[model samples]
Target: MQTSPENDLVTIEEAAAMLGTTTVNILMNLKRNLLQGQEIDGHWHVSKASLAAHGGDTKAAVSKPLCQRSTCGSCGQH
Candidate 1:
């Protein structure tokens, strides 16, 4: 739950794409503490750092800041 501007958080779908996996697997990983993420407004936001550390494809993750996304109401902190 410790989110800061330095930590780029991606939505579950984005994380799945970065890791090349399904959202369900990502959710299980999050619950198992195999990944680092936080739940925000009923949605799961995965940590880009953790994803990269776990060998995920960083290039596949969103290049722009999450704040720029249309669904920024819940992720405008960045």
Candidate 2:
């Protein structure tokens, strides 16, 4: 789904993408009360304002590493 700045709500996935982080990071933030969101229909809906306050920019693209393998020990995926 497409979201505009005028939109107040965003999904957890969207929030993660905006922050250039993973969904698990967003969930951890939510659990720690670092980010604000509401659970609806088994999904977490985050506030765009909250994300912005946390330095999450919807227009900012995430930088990908040269290696995209989950087995990379540098990313703790191994």
Candidate 3:
């Protein structure tokens, strides 16, 4: 939530919101090493730099509304 030049720790929910994706997607990316994150207090904290590096602002990739369930199964809602 508090992002500074030294520590830009963002919650998984925050990263998902920024990336226009779901928390599961972010977690999957973390597991696959596509994104960099640190586990703190049993929760994942991602860096703003890492998000930027992984093309976090990929709103274009999210075609459906966040609340809508996808039939394609790409959003992991199926």
Give the candidate number with the greatest TM-score: 3
Residue-by-residue lDDT tens digits, candidate 2, 14-77: 8877787788767766775767888877888787777777443432322223124465343465
Clashes of 1: 0
Off by over 4 Å in 2: 1-7, 56-78
How do the predictions measure up, each by TM-score? Answer: 0.61, 0.62, 0.64
Better of 2 and 3 by TM-score: 3
- Give the candidate order by descending TM-score: 3, 2, 1
Summarize candidate 3's per-residue lDDT along 1-78 as a digit string, tens digits.
655333877888988888887898778667756678888877788878777864534654333433264554555767
Off by over 4 Å in 3: 1-6, 55-78
What global local distance difference test value does model 3 have? 0.69
lDDT agreement with native, every candidate: 0.67, 0.64, 0.69
lDDT score of residue 1 within candidate 2: 73
Backbone clashes for every candidate come to 0, 0, 0
Please state the error at residue 23 of candidate 1 in Å: 0.1
